[model samples]
Target: MKLIDLNRDGEIGANCHYIQIGSLNLVIDSGLHPKKAGRRAAPDFGPIRGVHLDLIIITHCHLDHIGSLPVLLREHPEAPVVMSTSSRMLVERMLHNSANVMVRQKEEANIPEYPLFTHEEIDRIAKRLTGIPFGQAKRIQGGKDDITIILHPAGHVAGAAGVEIHHKRRQIFLTGDVLFEDQRTLPGAKFPAGRFDTLVMETTRGITARGSEKTRLIEVNRLIDSINDTIQRGGSYLIPVFALGRQQEILSIIHDARKFRRLVDCPIFAAGLGMDLADYFDEISRKTKHVRFNRGIIKELQIKPTPRKLNPGEDPQQNGLYIISSGMMVERTPSYTLASGLVGHARNTIGFVGYCDPDTPGGELLASKPGDQFLFKACNVKTKIKARVERFDLSGHADREELLEFAVQADPRVIVLTHGENEARAWFAGQLAEKLPKTKLIDPVPLQTYQV
Candidate 1:
C-alpha cells in the first residue's frame, strides 16, 4: 500500500490523506486548518488534481475532519463519501453551520474566499453522502480490485469512527480520533479484537500525561467546585468549549450536577451554533441511540443566550456562568472577547475543558503566570492575568497510554502516525521503537507518498 499525507502544513491541521491499495485510490479526510484563514487553510490537493478519487471516507463531523468536504466534492464529483450512521445525521448540519460561519467571516473579516461553499451547494450534495452501520461489511469495486470497508465506533465524539479495510488477504485499521474512556454523552470505543497488517492512529494526546488523580469523575467534580467558587465570589466563569461535542457534554454534566442540587444556583448562558446543535443531538439520541444528550437539558437549566454585545477588557455586567465556543479561544470569537474581560479580574475564572493548540490564545494564557501581562491582540485588550485560569482533564482525545497499549496489542507490521505535533509524534515514535523494535514506523511528511 502507498499513502500521501495531504494535510499541507501537517501536524493536526487540514487532515487529508490519500492512499492507494491494490487498484483503488481513497481519501480518508479533507479538513480545513484551524489556524490558517481562507483558501490557505484547506489541504493542498495539487497532487490529486487529475487523479480520480475512488472513495472519500469521513471519520466524523468535526471541522478538522470534514470541513472541506464540499470543497473536495466540488473537484471529485464522482467520488462517493461515506461515514458512520451517526455522522450522516450530523454531517449536513455541521457543513451548513460551516457555510453560515464562513458567510459571517467573509463580511466581518473581508475575506474573498470566506464561504468556500454555499448552502445551495450543500443541499445539492447532501444526498450523495452515505451512512454505513458499524461492523457491516460493504464492498466497493475499482477497476479489477475489490475491497471491503467497515467502520467501528471510535468514541471520541458522536459518530466518530475507526476505519477497517480488507483487500485480498491483508487487513488494515485506521484509528480516526479515538477515545477509550466513555464520556458523559457517549460510550467508549469498541474496536475489533484482532491483528492487522497495517495500523494508522492519531497521537493528539501523546505529550500529556494523565496522572492517577486526573480521572474523569475527579476532573468533573473539580470543574464544578471551581465554578461554585467563582460564582460565590461574585464573578462569571467562562468555559470555552468546542461547539459540537464538548458543549453538549459539558451541558449534560452540568445538568447532572444541578439535578442533584450539587451545583450552585446561577443563570447559565449559552448560545451560537452549539445551542442549535442541541436539537440535532436530541434527534440522534432518539434515532441512532449512539449518544445520550437531551435537548430538554437546556430548558431545565434555564439556559439563556449570551448577551449579543460583550465588551472586551471589561467584566460582563451580569455575573453568571458563560459557556461559549471556539474552544481554543481563537481570536475574534465570543470566548476570546469574554476572556479578555474576565481575565483582568480576580473574581472571574476561565476554565478550559478541551484541547487547545499551543499557538492559540487559550494555550498561551494557560502557559502564562498569574501576574503576567496577557494581551488579547485581536481585540486590542491588554491586562494582567488576575483571574483563575485552569484546565480540566476532560479532553475528548484518548490518553497516550491507552493509545500506545492499543497499538502494541494490534501488533501490526507497519504503523503510520498522524494528527499530532512534532514533539507528540516524536514521543510516540521513541516508545514504539523501544517496544516494537522490528516493526516499521512511518510518519509521512506533508503531501509526500510512502510505500508501507
Candidate 2:
C-alpha cells in the first residue's frame, strides 16, 4: 500500500490523505484550512489531479474535514462520497454555511475566488453522497481485488467515525479526528476491536502533557461555577464555540445546570451557524437516537438568538449568557464582534471551551493578561482586557495519553500520525518510541508518498 499526505501545511488544517492499495485509490478527507483563505485553504491536489479515486470517505462534518469536498468532487465526479447518515444531514447545512462565509469574505477580505463553490455546486455534489450506517461493511469495488469499507463511531461529534478498510488480505484503519470519552450530547467512541497491518491516527492534543488528566465532569463543573460567578457579579458570560460539536455540548451543559439549579436562571443567547446546526442535532437525536441530547433542550432553556448585527453602542450585557461561533474568534465573526463590546467591561467574563489556534483572535485574547491593551484587527478596534479571560479543557479531541493508550492497545505494525503540529507529532513519536520500540512509526512528509 502507498500513502501520501496532501495537506499543504503540516499542521491540523486542510486534512487530506491519499492511500493506494492494489487497484483501489482512496482519499480519507478533503478539508480547507480555517486559518487560510482561497486556494491556500485547500489541500494540494496537484499530485492527484487526474488520479481516478474509487472512493472518498468523510469521517465527520467539521469544516476542516469536509470543507474542500466540492473541489474534490468537481475533479472526480465519479468517485462516490461515503459518510455516516448523521454526517450527511449536517454536511449539507455546514457546506451551505461555508459558502455564505466565503461570499462574505469576498466583500470583507478582497478575495476574488471567495465562495469557492456555490450552493448550486454543493447541491450537485450532494447527489454523489451515499450515507451508510455504522458497523455495516459495504463493498465498493469487486473481483479478486475487492475493497470493502466499514465505519465505526469515533465520538468526536454526531456521525463522526473511524474507518476500517479491507482489501485483498490486508486491513487498514484510519482514526479520523476522534474522542474516546463521552460528552453531554454524544457517547464515547466504539472503535472496532483487534489489530491492523497499518494504522493512521490523529495527534491533535499530543503537545499538552496533562490534557487527558482532567475529566469531563470536572471541567463541566468548573465551567458551571465560572458562569455562576460571572452572573452573580451582574456580568454577562461569553463562550466562543465551534458551530458543530462544541456548541451543542455547551448548550446541553448549561441546560442541565439550570435544570439542577446549579446556575441561576438567566437569558441564554446563541448566534451564528451553531444555532442552525443545533436544530439539525435535535432532528438527528430524535430520528436515530445516536446522540443522547434531549431534542427539546433548546426550547426548554428558552435560548434567544442574537440579532445579526448589534446596534451602535448597544450593551449586549443584560447579565446573561452569550454563546457565539467562530470558535477561534476569527476576525469579523459573531464571537469577535460580541467580544469587542464585552472585553472592556470589568464585570464580564469570556470563557474558551475548546482548542484555539495560536494565531487566531481567541488565542490572542487568552494569552493576554488582565489590563492589557489588545487590538481586534477585523474592526480595527482596541480595547483593554478588563473582562476575565479563562479557558477550560473542553477539547473534543482525545487527550494525548488517551490517544497513546488507544494506539498501544490497537498494536498496529506500522503507525502513521497526522492532523497535528510539529510539536504534537514529535511528542507522540517520542512516547511511541519508548512504548513500542520495535514498531514502525511514520510522520508523513507533505506531498510525499510512502510505501508500507
Candidate 3:
C-alpha cells in the first residue's frame, strides 16, 4: 500500500496528497493553502485522476480537512464519501457555511470569483455522503480481495474518527485528529486493542504543551472571573471564537460558572454563525447531560445584532458579554470587525479561546507588548486600556506528552505524521523517535508517496 501526500501544509490552498493502493484508492482530507495575496492554491490531483476511489474518509468537519470534499466528489461523483453519522451532519452544515464564507470573502475582497467549486457542487457531494457507525467495518467491494475498513472515534470533535484499514496481511490505522488525554469536549481516543503494520496520524498540537482538562477549567474560570471583575467596572467581554468546538465549550463553561455563582451576569452575546452553531451544542447538552450548563445556558443566551448588516455607522450594544467567530480577528469575519470596533474601549475585555496563527490579528494582540493598546479603525472609539487579554488552555488537539502516550499504546511498526507544518511535525517526529526508537517514523513531503 502506498500513501500520497495531499495538502501537507496546515492552511488550505496549500499542497495536498492523494493515495492509491492496489485496486482501491483512498483520499483522506483534501484542502488548499491560502496564497500570499489571499487566493487559494489548489493541489495537484493528476496522479490519482484515472484511479477509482473505493472509499473516502473525512477526519473531522474542519474546513481544512473537508474543504476539498466537493472538489473531489465533483470529479469522482461515483465515489462515496465515508464518515461518521455525526460528521456527516456536521460537515453538511460546515461545508454549506464554508460556501457562504467564500462568497462573502470574494465580495469583501472585491475578487470577482473564488476558483473553488460552487455551492451546487458542495450539495452534489453532500448527497453522496454515506454515514458509518463507529466500530462497524465495511467492505469496499463485494469479494474477499477488496478493502475492508473500520471507523473508530478519534475524540477530536463530536463525531470525528480514525479510519482503520484491514487489507490482507496489513492493518493500517489512520488517526485523523485525536484527543489523547484530558479532553473536555469528548473522551480521549481509545487505542484499538490490536497491533498495526503502519500508523498515519496528524500532529497538529504534537509538539505543544497541554495541561489537564480540570486544571484548564480552573485557569479559564479564574481568567473569566478577572474579566468579569473588569466588566463589573463597566467593561464588556469580547471572545473571538470558532463556531464549532471552542464556542460550545466556552459557552458551557461560562454557563456552569454562572450556575455555581462563580461568574456574574453580563449579557452573553453570541454573534454571526456562532448563534446558529450553538444549537448543536445545546442539543448535545440536552441529550448527553455530560456537558455542564449552569447559569449562562446557550438556549437562554440572547442573540447579538448583526452589526455589519446594520446601518454603516451603528455600534453594537457596548455593555454586555459577546462572542464572535474568526477567533483570531484575522479573518474579515464578524469577530474581526467587532474587535476593531471594541478595541481601545476602556470598558471592554477580549479573551482568546483558541489557537491563533502568528499572522492573525488575535495573535498580534496576544503577542503585543503588555503596555500597548490595540487600535480600532471601525467604530472610531479610543477608550482606555480597561480590556483584559488572556488565553485559555482548552486546546482541541493532544499535546506532546499525550502524543507519546498514544504512540506507545498503538505500538505500530511504522508511524507517518501528517497535518502539521514542517517544523512542528519534525519536532513531533524527534519526540516519537526518542520514545519509540524501533518504529519507523516518516515525515512526508507534499505529494510524496509512501509504501507500507
What range of 10 consecutive residues in model 2 has the weakest lDDT sum?
307-316
For candidate 2, the per-residue lDDT at 446 reads 94
lDDT of 2 by residue, 1-452 (tens): 89999998877999999888887888998999999999999999998999989899999999999999999999898899999988988898999999999998999999998888999999888889988999899998832366889999999999999999998788889999898988899998989777788899999998876544567888889999999999999999989999998998999999889889898878998877887777788888988778876648889999888866763223576899998887898888888888888899989999999999998999989889999998887787788889999999988898888889888887888999999999999999999989988789999999998998
**Any idea what lDDT model 1 has?**
0.93
Ranking by TM-score: 1, 2, 3
Better of 1 and 3 by TM-score: 1
What residue pairs clash in candidate 2, if any at all? none
Which lDDT tens digits does candidate 1 get at residues 1-452? 99999999989999999999999999998899998889898998898888888899999999999999999999999999999999998999999998988998898779898899999999999888999988889998998799999999999899999999999999999999999899989999999987889999999998999999999999999999999999999989999999999999999999999999989999999999899988988998998888998999999999999989988887874779999898999988999999999999999999999999999999999999999999999889999999999999998899999999999999999999999999899999999999888789999999888998
Output the TM-score of candidate 2: 0.97
Candidate 3 stretches greater than 4 Å from native: 8-17, 32-41, 142-144, 181-185, 211-214, 281-296, 302-317, 373-386
- lDDT at 74, model 1: 96
Candidate 3 lands at a TM-score of: 0.88
TM-score of each: 0.98, 0.97, 0.88
Question: Each model's RMSD to truth, in Å?
Answer: 1.0, 1.5, 3.5
Give the poorly placed runs of model 2, Cα more than 4 Å off: 142-144, 211-213, 311-315
Candidate 1 Cα RMSD (Å): 1.0
Instruction: Give the alpha-carbon lDDT of every model.
Output: 0.93, 0.88, 0.67
Clashes of each: 0, 0, 15
